[model samples]
Target: MTLVRDIREDDAQDWRRLWAGYNDFYEASVPTEVTEYTWRRLLDPTSSLIGRIAEIDARVVGFSVSVLHDSSWTSSPICYLEDLFVDPSLRSGGVGRALIQDLVDLGRARGWSRLYWHTQANNQRARRLYDAFVEADDFVRYRLTL
Candidate 1:
């Protein structure tokens, strides 16, 4: 059975491996220094970032990061799933689903009004899994680099 829990300081190596896999999946590169900074932030109590790791047989195989923010449209807070990644070898083993379900539970416990995430339009596998739980919105996203 797969288990999901909040990320701990001792799971640094496992977190790094998952982080690298996440970046590789998107064909993106992140500097080691930046990754270290992010890792520290995730573990910092003063930081808003919250992370959870999925483990099976004591081995971490996936992770998800979420952030809570106050929404202008709603008085309650919103939980935004910023990142989620599962090891390719462990796909379809319910790890991802467990992580997401955990996130949903967390949101509910915290009185969050909404929990949402986005992925590449062409990510068919992720989309398939996501569609099972929620419908895609009609809006398009645009980004402007500073």
Candidate 2:
């Protein structure tokens, strides 16, 4: 059985391992400083970031990180699922689905206005999982890096 739960202080090492795998899969080379900062933010109570981990028989196998923020379009907060990854070996084993379902349950309980996320157009594997929840909107995303 897969168990999903909020991230804890002791999960740093396991989280880092999964995090590294996540970055590797995306071919992203996030700097060490930024990675450390993100870990700290996830553990900070006052931060808007929320982190959850998935464990199968006590071994961490996946994780999801989301951000909560007030939205101008709605009276309630919105949840943006920033990062989600399952161990490559454990893909298709229900961990990914469980993590997203956990977020959906959390959003419903918290009265979030919406929950959304995005991925590269070529990420068919992830798109398949995401599409199971909702159809993709016809929205284009642009970024400006300073």
Which candidate wins on TM-score? 2
Score residue 41 of candidate 2 by CA lDDT.
Answer: 95
Candidate 2 structure, TM-score to reference: 0.98
Give the lDDT of residue 94 in candidate 2: 91
lDDT (Cα, tens digit) per residue for candidate 2, span 23-93: 99999999999999999999998999999999999999999999999988999999999999999999988
The lDDT of each candidate is: 0.91, 0.96
TM-score for all models, in order of appearance: 0.96, 0.98
Q: Name the candidate that leads on lDDT.
A: 2
Residue 99, model 2: Cα distance from true site in angstroms: 0.6
Model 2 ranges off by over 4 Å: none
lDDT per residue, candidate 1, 1-146, as tens digits?
88999889999999999899899899999899999988998899778888899999999999999887888999998889999999999898788889999999988998899999999999999988898889999989899979
The TM-score obtained by model 1 is 0.96
Model 1 C-alpha RMSD to native: 0.9
Whole-model alpha-carbon lDDT for candidate 2: 0.96
